[model samples]
Target: GTPDAEEPTVTAWGLEGSSLRPGQPSPALEDWEEASEWTSWFNVDHPGGDGDFESLAAIRFYYGPARVCPRPLALEARTTDWALPSDVGERVHLNPTRVFWCLNREQPRGRSCSNYHVRFRCPLEATWGSWGPWGPCSGSCGPGRRLRRRRCPSPAGDACPGRPSEAQKCVRPRCPGCGPNTCGCPDHILLGSVVTPSGHPLPGARVSLRDWPGTVATSDAHGTFRMPGVCASSRANVSAQMDGFSAGMAQAQANSSMSAVATVVLNKLEKPYLVKHPESRVREAGQNVTFCCKASGTPMPKKYSWFHNGTLLDRRTHRYGAHLELHGLRPDQAGTYHCKAWNDAGAVRSGTARLTVLAPGQPACDPRPQEHLIKLPDDCGQPGRGPTYLDVGLCPDTLCPSPAGSSPRCGDAGSRCCSVSRLESRKVHCSGYTLPVKIVAECGCQKCLPLRGLIRGRVVAADSSEPLRFARILLGREPIGFTSYQGDFTLEVAPSTQRLVMTFVDPSGQFVDTVRVLPFDPRGAGVYHEVKAMRKKAPIILDARQSNTISLGEMGEEAPLAAGIIPPGAFRSADGQPYTGAVEAQV
Candidate 1:
């Protein structure tokens, strides 16, 4: 019979190309114990309803290795109305709970399908209403409880299928100094302080208990006033008033014998003064940062503002709830920051809090799990090995201007040179970059000069072939020392074989001559070279390509100077007589 005309017999079908074909019923359908074997690709067929009903029209099945294939299962009727006969096949009530295959398939072996398409109509699902507001906390402190509830829509029989409400424990943060069992102490002292908005003490200010009238007390020079034997098992309020200042009141609950320090700040018609200021912070580039400012002034300072790098912050960009919160901080957000508390009297600025943001690859510090010292990585840079210092700068290849552009040179292009003065095995503390990395014994920039090698040699005269003693030896125009009696000297030179200029100065600090020496071999820890000195003459220049040949007379002109000539006063004798041309002058 057509599905639209009468109750057509319902049968299990094998899935094919876009159609369902009659197939043998599951072999385990009669024997319930074997049902597990067919549960993968087989589901019991049920009778159809007469009128239109709600059901899943199509379902996609995924199976095989890595869920490769996707097959869609769809339901179709013989007629357009999709009407089913009232007298369909006998229906079984074995699954009274109406459990159907909802993508729950067991993997089968030996060419058997691991997943099968499912297309059928059952009944409309029951929908639940919106959840209610959470209930109040069960306790004031410690672990508390709260709950929210929801219900199924009307017309749903009996009760909802799942839980009607959800419950969870609410945690209450413990107040500082309010230990377990101490918060309820009945015996407590009533003490407080009177201060200006700036937190400065106001001595001789009158303070009186609010709950118990006439219980007056006068503040000491320290601004502290105490009232002993006062009952504060629950709460108490105290007021302070002084001349030329507005009155102020404070409230507190006595939790301990050491009553919480209640501060009553009296307002004055003057500029605001900060009582609390934000602190310097070092945090990740993308993180939330907050700053707090507390101040007091006349009219209670109604307006609050924040500034970054001396520029006022837009109110819409940052959140203010008793403190300033910068959401999702970036590198640009790092700078010196402060807050302002203002009113009709005047505005007061708080102490600046510096925020540092480190670029990638820079040394970073991560908090220690259970310790006060921060843990750093191994590559954060090393500590000082000795008192020696070196400067490093990034540069182009053309830096230092060598005759032959062959060696690497550091110039003042893009580098931050910082001195590492801390002793060996000590931590490296940088002011702007406070984030601690691995504390190494040797500290320096990422790229630095290699360890220097000692260059030992003797300087001798070229013509006489004799050792030149008491002569000054220089490395690259810098005088290292004067030659000893043996004419032997040792100098430290940085690694790398490069052209270097060494100048020799006579003992009289005159007659200086410069010579170009061949590059030293850096393969060894120390190098030995014998320098041949020549008499003072025209300057000598060396070409790196022909370094072996020293071309003299490159320096053109040498002007004459009357140096070493005694002045007129020194020529006169002690008698103040300019005696000359006579016999001898100390011969």
Candidate 2:
């Protein structure tokens, strides 16, 4: 048999190995989903039939219009044995439009093209993911902005149609105005905090100026306060008082921002406590990751430090703070991480979290496929051996890896599947002959496409049973196909389509136009229907001076329900012109 013809060379996909960039991935991949779409794996061609040519034009010839997207973003190809083209080294041609590999076309004499399948990735649309948690404030004081972001629709992590992040003004209810003369506090504004004797946050406490009795500010839930408009002698003598404890006083060190630690501890001493801790993660090399932790205390623990595997992580390099962010992670970066919070009262360390990093070419999934048994033809089995069954072997339906790697997007990471990475051809003994069958030799991970559903039938006239040759066929208002000379037609039904509505028009005008609603399987099964059309009535001469009746048309043996009748002197021209020499009527 001849080889499968190649697709247009506008974009040739090189054999993917270590550089198989992906467009979509699995659940453990990204936190957000993509707006892009994918077609299910399709195996329209078999090795036994013309050596398995999975060309785009050939596929479109078999499956009709709209089965494939007009413009695809990416293409994936793999053999039935779940082997990638990169892993197998097949002389295959791949693009967004087609995936072609002919049996032994350019390989050794014994080599052949495996049964293959393919899928396409469509262009990104306007889909979006859920909004993420809000981030830390941009400023360390009041009226600063905090931001939260949402995920856009592309597997390639492309920017969305508009701004991906949303911002809102946020005022710190806790620890307001970190430094004096900052956060719009120019007049030596005093900032202080009130905490319980045991280091717990004192929600509602009052702090007032020593000289101005009415000039007071309440401590917020985070046990912090900020007050302005009081500039006397380079200091602010403020007193803190909570309902359960006695009054405590502290003088603000307004002249020095570094020494401006104005906190009124009810019992004089407090210990730091953990509020948030870092989380463990697994990532691939050359990717970015972040770890975060938080703490609270009497003096509001202002110092945060991070450690990796007992070694202190650099503050300037990793940006270690309440949040520690790492970029372009390498395999050497994998280790246990912890954070420490410190204040004058005491110091406390957070629980440790682990980080796992993988190399780019490493397989995250097992390369072996599971066992799958298939039954052969009835006559192929022995009389007492019951129905013949063979272990064809199959990979699980779950997501797997591919040489063309999966995108680390929201849907599925490594969008490849566990499939036949290896297979063998065999001949089984029948009663009088042998039947050739392909059995799974081995299975691994390969990308696959979904199948396209089909609808087929023939069109003919109701009276003479003649084929409705070359009639135009339309799905809705869009013309999709035409009947063959034998009146045979085929239609491909997309998975997203809910119903099939088609209109058939005869070019000869001898038959009336026909419209029908068809039923089909959404999961890529085939359906058939026979359409019957009615012939138009022939013209006949009529008398305008006497009563006359005319019959319209009929279907099968049913009575003709359409007709017209006229009495004498009823004939008249549409305009003021006289009637024609002969009155001709057709219904």
Candidate 3:
């Protein structure tokens, strides 16, 4: 089969938006033949003072003698703008084994070879050249990747069967106490941070050098710590410890040129603690009953074992977890049931709950409400001994029948909750007058949404009393509502919310973005919080001198030429507030 007329992968080199550079090459002026091996880009002369004279001997003289091919397979010649030798419209010479030169005298008056560079492609050995030496480790310390390369001998042939480039894991020798080339040296300061598993900064963590005693530091509220004279561009083993977390260690990356920063991640730990436990349930013999148990711990409990009358139940047959659903309950299955939660730290056994299964056609719930007592506030207490107590009454969570096609589905289908069906408003006579209280008078099953309480607040400027009106209210990142014109806002808190996280964004940019984590009451009770928003932009200092005029790099710097002038205060912090902290001017 004939070889594919593969075009040489010509890479454009030099300045952007420019037609010519000192010795830059054009992308399109290279040879179209497939390349077996290519010498590094060689340029022996510049397009200044005289015409560029890039001879083969000159390239070998400046570079190593083995850098150039004695006899070449193909040659490429180009101007910086991709103009080929034919299109250059100037007298020049490009010999594959000799030299690529251009004389100003030979070019048309006031013209030259557009600044040139050359490349040579040569035939190869069997399939590929021997693999080159492995490159330096990508990372200064610890594990990283290293690369080595080999060249296909014949680009015209089927790609030498395998990859031309290869990579492997690079392992640097671990340093005990800042040893040889393994560590970068001369760095002055070492900076590190301790964070929770969720990446939140964990303040108050004590950080100390692994082997250096008395060298201790503490993370601030931002979870960051600094150590001076730590690493001379050397690797430093650092560890962090806190009260309720596993000790975490990290290799601090430090070197001569910059301040070294490392992050130590701490895993919060706690013994298995039960948050929700199984409760006693009464159900008809043929009905289903479900008991749920939840445990909270670091590395959340994933293993739960249920027991029946002190006997461990077969997990393979039951296949239940935190929630155990028993279908077609039998009298024998009715007994004290409990669950044991296990985590890496420890295991906890939940309190036992009784499962009473009655015969068919039996009522599972009592119609009468239990007498529940409540404590009145200290100011509303009796003048005598203990605080006055009132019988507010209570409704148990028992199974009850549902009404005909009405209210929300209570518990599960065909089942309901024994909830407060009626409430009686009474007065508790106190020192001054009386405090009105609602007492549970009846218990029945209906629907259950249980109206949630409201979260009300007013967003206003922190420094000034100006209201932050019409700000978007985001609940768990979803748009829930907007503040009114008076900056007052209210929304019903979700029933399952333990932490109410909200973000208020000001579309008008008058206020910095505000994020708040509010305390929540699991019971249906309204919570009030005042939100103070910091004003956004601030007046910044500037250098108004004429010497501070920006020169916009007619000199060819990639950055804007505003070196002498104070930069505009257009920069913002990560939270979208006007940045007022320390900033590096060089950046």
| Cα RMSD (angstroms) for every candidate in the order listed | 32.1, 33.7, 36.2
lDDT of the structure predicted as candidate 3? 0.68
User: C-alpha displacement of 63 in model 1, angstroms?
Assistant: 57
lDDT (10s digit) by residue, model 1, range 386-413 = 2322222222211111111222222212
Tens digit per residue, CA lDDT, model 2, 1-587: 33235534321233221234432222121322434556667676777633556767655434433566676655566778867654665556565655554545555466676777877665545557888999987655444677999977666665666777898755553333343322333444566778765566675888876544343789876787777644423355678876545567877765554334467777544577776667565566876666767777666788899887776765654556787777677776788989899976789999887777768876654556567788889998877878888877666654433233334332232335556677789999887898888877766666555546899999999878899999999976579999999999998886545457788999998888999998989778899999998888887898777777887566668998787677766664532233534587766
Q: What local lDDT score does residue 382 receive in model 3, on the 0 to 100 scale? A: 51
Which stretches of candidate 3 lie above 4 Å from their native place?
Answer: 1-282, 290-315, 320-324, 330-362, 368-415, 419-449, 508-513, 520-523, 536-587
Inter-residue clash pairs, candidate 3 = 184-233, 185-232, 185-233, 186-232, 186-233
176-253 per-residue lDDT for model 3 (tens digits) = 354423233334578888987667788899998754443379998778898765654556788898878877888877
Instruction: Please give the lDDT score at residue 249 for candidate 2.
Output: 82
Task: Report the Cα lDDT for residue 71, model 2.
Answer: 69
Candidate number with greatest lDDT: 3
Evaluate model 1: give its lDDT: 0.49
> Which candidate model has the greater TM-score, 2 or 3?
3
lDDT of each: 0.49, 0.66, 0.68
Q: Which stretches of candidate 2 lie over 4 Å from their true place?
A: 1-371, 376-388, 396-418, 424-445, 519-529, 540-586
